[model samples]
Target: MAADTTPPALQDFLTWRLHRLAKLTDRQSSDAYTQVFALGVGEARCLAAIGQFAPLSVKDLAAQANLDKAQASRAAQMLVDRELVLKSASETDARGVVLTLTRSGRPLWKRVMRLIEQRNADIFGCLTKAEQRQLEAVFDRLIAHADARPQGSSPATP
Candidate 1:
């Protein structure tokens, strides 16, 4: 049989679909964070990273949150201004400061964790446990492939 020549629809593209889902989820989570905790998405990312892994430096938090250093620093400072995080001089590294959730931030972090769990359930609860595991494995492989690409090589460009 002759090959079909029809172009794939935009919605049928995996990359486009993945990006659509990401944007939708990000918007939903961002709205909830802003309404409930007065945190923007960037700030929420930083806060969540620090809350999950205390004593992290701005550099480490940036890496964990997949944000640039400047954005991470700004988010960290915002959290500091709100008293949600305590930035203290690192005992091991005098040049660096460690970030940890404040007494008030702990409860907020718990709330954020609950929100995240609920969001995951809402998005993926339809998938069976086996299907979820398969999806996770595919995601891991995609992440590894993306990570292995050379910097500045745009996936969208030839």
Candidate 2:
């Protein structure tokens, strides 16, 4: 009967490392968005989602932007208030509302897309083309595996 001497290190955790990377890139993107577009990260994401996939409902935008419904709704409202996006009645669902970029927002959306391209290049520039392709494949597989798992289910013990 003895207490365990070994302890887990934060650096050894894959999730923590991934989160750190995500935070770093997200911070950089957030700063860029705020400085260039005067937008919060959520607002920028909502705008991008609406621009890329017009006629989206709040729920659809949330999924597209990887945001919660509440966050998406709030961002959509802000975009609507700023006249960057138009909110209209959904054609399929009478009670549901659809979101689309406004005429003024088109140019902004193009700029945003360019900024995204630049940011991607800046972030992944260190990796070789082969490495980038491998990384993308690995990420796709991991995402697919995670998506296939049932919610709230714990991983099996190694």
Candidate 3:
């Protein structure tokens, strides 16, 4: 289906939401930088993706995290050096490697999840039931639009 390009209001709303999310993400990353690996935003994202999808290969992990192969590979190595993740050669493909969290990272992962959950609750807690419903509907619509768009195209143009 063709996107409804005529809805200027929808475009505006999406743009505003994107900016708001960016700001929120920046704040979170900066606040946690000293505590974490002084990692930039992308590194934090890589860590979360690894936590969520452990035992994934570098290529798969990059795709899951919306990162490029180089970035993901670098992050994976960094995580291994930090003793947060483990990397082992894939049994199925000798050239491929899979990454997973190490034993020591369990507590840190849990702490990060709790902190993020609290922030999410704080951000959306003020919305009423109806508002929450509307927000979900809007988010769904945005995702549909995104899915319909071509790959390699970003919503936030640089």
The most accurate candidate by lDDT is 2
The parts of candidate 1 lying over 4 Å away from their true place are 1-8, 91-94, 153-158
lDDT of each residue in 1-158, candidate 1, tens digit only: 98998998999999899999999999998998899888998998888899998889999999998799999999999999999999999998989999999999888888888888888888899999899999999999999999899988975854
Q: Write the per-residue lDDT of candidate 3 for residues 40-139, one digit (tens) a residue.
A: 5555666777788888898988887778999888877887888888889899998999888888866666766666676667677899979988998998
Taking the tens digit of each residue's C-alpha lDDT, what string does model 2 give over 1-158? 99998989988999999999999999999999999999988999999989999889999999999899999999999999999999999989989999999999889988998998899999999999999999999999999999999989997897
As for TM-score, the candidate ahead, 1 or 2, is 2
Superposed by TM-score, candidate 2 places the C-alpha of residue 76 at a distance from the truth, in angstroms, of 0.8
The pairs that clash in candidate 2 are: none
For model 1, the local distance difference test gives 0.91
TM-scores, all candidates, are 0.83, 0.92, 0.72
**Clash statistics: count for each candidate:** 0, 0, 0
The global C-alpha lDDT for each of the candidates, from Candidate 1 onward, is: 0.91, 0.94, 0.77
- Among residues 3 or more apart in sequence or in different chains, the pairs in candidate 3 whose N, CA or C atoms overlap within 3 Å are none
**Better-scoring candidate (lDDT), 1 or 3:** 1
